[model samples]
Target chain A: MSEYTPLSEVGEFGLIRLINEKIELRNSSTIKGIGDDAAVLEPGEKQIVVSSDMLLEGVHFDLTFCPLKHLGYKAVAVNVSDIAAMNAKPTQITVNIALGARYTVEAVEELYEGIRLACENYKVDLVGGDTTSSHGGLVLSVTAIGEVAKGESVLRSGAKVNDLICVTGDLGAAYMGLQILEREKQAFMANPDMQPELEGKQYIVGRQLRPEARMDVVYDLKERGIKPTAMIDISDGLASELFHICKQSGVGATVYKDNLPADEQMLQTALDFNIDPLTCIMNGGEDYELLFTVPLSDHEKLKNHPDISIIGVITEESEGINLATKHGNSYPLKAQGWSHF
Target chain B: MSEYTPLSEVGEFGLIRLINEKIELRNSSTIKGIGDDAAVLEPGEKQIVVSSDMLLEGVHFDLTFCPLKHLGYKAVAVNVSDIAAMNAKPTQITVNIALGARYTVEAVEELYEGIRLACENYKVDLVGGDTTSSHGGLVLSVTAIGEVAKGESVLRSGAKVNDLICVTGDLGAAYMGLQILEREKQAFMANPDMQPELEGKQYIVGRQLRPEARMDVVYDLKERGIKPTAMIDISDGLASELFHICKQSGVGATVYKDNLPADEQMLQTALDFNIDPLTCIMNGGEDYELLFTVPLSDHEKLKNHPDISIIGVITEESEGINLATKHGNSYPLKAQGWSHF
Candidate 1:
């Protein structure tokens, strides 16, 4: 058995040494890590992209339904998704975690294990971070760094009229997954002996707990020799992200109601939660899917891509953003994105 | 009377609009901010220095003793200190804050007011950040970006044997200030009607509540044509930082106890608190002063500098770190740095 030395015993330096003892730098750009005043990165000849996200314990995730390991993975993945939205490759990340006294060394190790796994999968290096104690719940803040050629990065403002709007993978699944987890939590709270009804909801649950950013879509676009005009991640639902692209790019869009992709399980889950399936597809957040705009001439190349859906096309700003319904009515789109404040 | 809207009522988009409504980008390097998937910076031909710090409410500051405005100012100041330690000039910062339900709009404005003041004082742009709700107390995470020309930035691993070690201004005053604040807090808690005994403790109190980062020292060093061989800020304590420099530079140090700098008020305050003055000067943290090493030839140049104290010289690695007492006994130095964990 290992000795149980309280953090108070060694103070901050001792704790820093204990935590940083196992960290080995792997990237050439990482000139420094935990020992210096700040981690140094040399992003030679490439424009670096920086994204930061903060996750709170009770607001972002419930400990009852989310494992610490998955929480750590999701934190890194969501930040990486922001970089992926720029069509850049994630290269390094700094993770700052605030843990309460309730957590043990073993628990922190489990969290870092998930972080390590995500880093390995994404080929990103864990460069540096600050770790401290929290007065209450856990807080994880991740800053991800990515790189693209000087003029090659896809920005939200780059979309133009006639660009083909595209979305990768199905939406509304992560929101549906959250609903299932909340229902199970409520059920378990009401009746402790009741078994969780989670047998068939594994896919949605996994999406909620450990959603992967579509780096694969980034690679595929490169392989097909097509550069998107603009891109963003659908973390705050399809409709909200579409509005962002339109507003920033000074363009308008009309998304076909039927082309808003959703898995069958997602639809059923939304129905069970008394939420409109269409509304869930439009406004459900945390999907971690990529939304991009490609030139109309490149449509043929991506038209048959299995995981991608050609949802709409951009229009002149005077036309206004709209949703073309199955019943042939066009309604102006409104963003109902996720807000933490 | 002002209106009060529940965050859930306004939802996320409305909150984003409320927070970002007044923010305007002042720097050309800020290619994108809140509207984009990720903030982009164009650090043209300059190496960028990035540092992150997380401040929890009770762990880092008590609401009773710290006004929200000072807390905000201190938060930005501390992050700027990290960049200053690298011999770089801060250009932009991103602040992420998570607040509990009890916070009001006015309170947030107060916090932002202090942040704005710091930005103006430091000439740093408030580029981008996330504002979110927390489950418990307040948390602020600030990431500072700074610029340094190639080969101009200093690191902690450049000190050589026989190099003279220099420290700016005084040490231990902040720690003493904290002690007085705590004592007053306890006294006020025990007797609600008691007036705080804060008349003569202004210097130490200010040191603790609003410690300024040694940006002036960095600028002075540049003006004097003196580049430190190695440098670090006295955030964790003098001894802790010295230990870091020695370990990284592969050299030891011998600091003269008589050369240790301590403010008169700090010495008196330590005596009043029944703590050793020399002990406080050596191990007390959060001074926000600069500790550096320079070639012995440069010592004469800085000998007349008012703010600098040449406390020691680098020693061979086999000698180990030592502190020579005024009475002639040498003791092996130890780091009892502040512990948040």
Candidate 2:
């Protein structure tokens, strides 16, 4: 195989065909997919929801540890997570990628492999997008289209006083995973012969490298005939998302410190690094968990679910957003979500 | 004003609010805009058409010659042009932008100013997006959502033998404008006191810096009771787009070289640079014009339209795509569209 086939050799049309052949559309709403100026969808009676996110290299990830395939999967997963947060089922996604000339056909194929895998896993169609050259590094921007019954889609502003605050899966695992990866990268750079010290760190590392969107939770809740009054994906930490809900819903929340779910491996890694687990859970970003609220009457349906934890309850605006400690003390919660700049 | 206020000072939420406040939704279909995980739209009986495009600094635009305001407008206009290519009316757009730390709050506002202006001009709503910091340089990604009655949206594969090919507006002015801009930049760099030779060049320069999507032609066609058999936007070039239509429709085209439309200014500039005007009209990029085909029965309806030109006639696949010159010589057409990679 050639060490590197310059992208110019493939040309724009060749590269487009190369990527287009690999996509398999799974959504029935997709009337036409790719190979066109725009993707067409038949949404029918359902209202359509759309959201877009852009990720830049060096700002969002370090290439030293990030694999192109994993990066592609993460980009799609993160965007789908946003759709799930709206209590809407993602029907299609358009992924636009701009890459520097240093990449080869093989490199792009790897990235699309991950993207296609995620599309299949999420059961969403690969609809339309643009492939272009970048000045340098890789820039990925994804727009997800979803559908929900009119008035059924949830929003951050729907929470009210007495609403029960709940969260899906565990928090801070992805954050701890990043720290481990960073340390391993430094050691590997110092000694080219050293293998990564990743033993017993598989869970956390996987969380960081391939965090899954909580679509299962959305499905599970719908099956149980429950609707979250408010919902948001935990891309920017729990406390920060809580602030969004509180500020928008004109309410307050009190989450217990002990109730915050932390994986055993995540906690252990946090201790080893002398980083407080609570801080990681509160401030570290990219967990992709679901943070939502339900009315008090619906608590019985969710309390028994092992994947979910009832962490707190909503309160009047005067009560303020606070974190209640195991020691019975409450303090105002501050948001320190990822601020790349 | 504070000199170069670091973006870190305002945080992501603040930046979001700064841009969001300026956007006012004009589309009644937009049930919910920004501040939610996704924007909701009610398209009723119309089919949803979506398209996304990403623009990277240095690759898609040179900041030295392109102003931020025009760049933002161009980014959104280009994506809308894709939707128009499908014969759809764009309703909403989501814009995602990544900027380097060198960008000030003022710079971001200026970019959004252009975006808002384009949205207003196109009657599109600014529905949802993510704003984040980049590693360096500027990156803009826009997703345009449009709606058309079921079976009304045009496709590249609809053209049949004997269909009359039509093109809107003029071509190649944007490419010449870029050439003039590059020349002026080089001259200005070499001699600080030298003035730009851009007088009487507004038409070409406007085409390059702020090309508008041809939605006017779509409306006119609807009024004239004509539906294009096949349609595509002249983004890459007229020849490149015609190639797409031919490949998808399983037909060939015969375009008269003399019938291809070119602005007087564009023709003069091509002569000044010693560039073949025919090549410029056929292969130059960024025109953002619409190319479509109408049945012979509807040809008389469009023949009287001042802005529309009957450029060619479709032929059987066996004949091959060819161009006929004024002197009666014919040759196979080649699509040398922009291949930046």
Give residue B279's error in model 1 in angstroms.
2.5
Q: For candidate 1, write residues B97-141 as lDDT tens digits.
A: 898877777778778878888877777877667788997999999
| lDDT tens digits by residue: candidate 2, A1-341 | 77867778889889999999888888789999998899999988999999899888887877788898999999999999999999999989999999888888888988999999999999999998999888778899999999999888999999989999999999999989999999999999999898999899999999998989899999999999999999999999999999999999999999999899889999999999999999989987789999999999998899889999999999999999999998999999999887767
Deviation of model 2 at B263, angstroms: 0.9
Candidate 2's DockQ: 0.85
- Cα lDDT, model 1, residue A261: 84
Task: Please provide, for model 1 over A159-225, each residue's C-alpha lDDT reduced to its tens digit, 9 standing for 90 to 100.
Answer: 9999999999999889889999999999999999989899878988899999998899899999999
Least well predicted 10-residue stretch by lDDT in candidate 2 chain A? A1-10
Off by over 4 Å in 2: A1-4, B1-4
Cα lDDT computed for each candidate against the true fold: 0.86, 0.92
Q: List the residue pairs that clash in candidate 1.
A: A339-B12
Q: Backbone collision count in every prediction?
A: 1, 0
